[model samples]
Target: MPVKAKATYESVRDAVNQLEKEGKEVNPTNVLNLTGGSRSTVYKFLSQLQDEDTKRQIKKPLPELEDLINEQSTAIITSLYEICKHRAEEVVLTEYETMKKRFADLQKTAEHMDLIEEKYQLKAQNFELQELKLKTENQELKEQNKILKDQVQTLKEQITALNKIINKQ
Candidate 1:
């Protein structure tokens, strides 16, 4: 009689993996055929493999999902921040342009007011010169009027003296 080698845990696990690689179902029959184990022993090992697979499936995806969620959150936050910053810069630039235009307009208005003030100042000086000349002319006219009055009085006295002399003759 030929003696069969006893199967170990590593041997059964390798047999199951080989069967899966060959696209075969990892049943107790297939695992026992590869590792030369009893039906009951292959069944026990297969159950252990199934339990481990279930544990891996449960434990594996949580960290991956957390990483993916973190990446997506970071991207969304960065996009929102960029949008807000760009809008703020645009608003500031628009306000700056508007203020610059307003400042220029104010400067023009100030220049116009300055021109009006200079023109009025020239007119006031001209009026002052004309008033001074008129005052000088009035003073000369008053002096001439006094001299004419004195001459008229002297002529009237001479006429009275001639009349008296003729009556006496």
Candidate 2:
């Protein structure tokens, strides 16, 4: 739609630039008001600008933006889109790799925890075995002490009997 005939391209450009300078998103309706043109005229001017930008991109092409603009302008938007897409893909791949490495580290940490748990279990079992051995040894020593006490009592009784018999004689 030759936007140049209906609206002064310069005016539309100035309005859009002014809106940007004011920290506002340039809308077609605002551009129409700024340029004193109809909404359709504003849209045509925007398309024309997009077309020029797209045309400037002859060396490279972008796939997504190609669908948004005409084929002739596709080359321009395409090149820019390709550059942006390339950078975006690189950032995504780097994040994905970092996540994978962190996951691997977590897996290793879990394995290390499992190893520590096994060591603790083995040490606990060894402690229990030592305790059981000490208990058994204590019981054996008590039994031996009882037997010695009984033997000492029996020998005293025999000595007393021999003494009485000798006194009788």
- Give all candidates' CA lDDT scores: 0.78, 0.80
Q: Which numbered prediction scores highest in lDDT against the true structure? A: 2
Expressed as tens digits, the lDDT of each residue in 1-169 for candidate 2 is 2223346778888878888899988888777767775776777788677667655754455576664565655556577777886998899899999999999999999999999999999999999999999999999999999999999899999999999999999
Error of 1 at 63 (Å): 5.6
Query: Candidate 2, 125: how far from true, in Å?
Result: 0.3
Pairs clashing in candidate 1?
A: none
Q: What is the TM-score of each candidate against the true structure?
A: 0.50, 0.54
Candidate 1, residues 1-169, lDDT tens digits: the string is 1223766677788988898899999887777878885777777777677667754644554467786886576567657766876898899899999999999999999999999999999999999999999898889888888888878888788888988988899
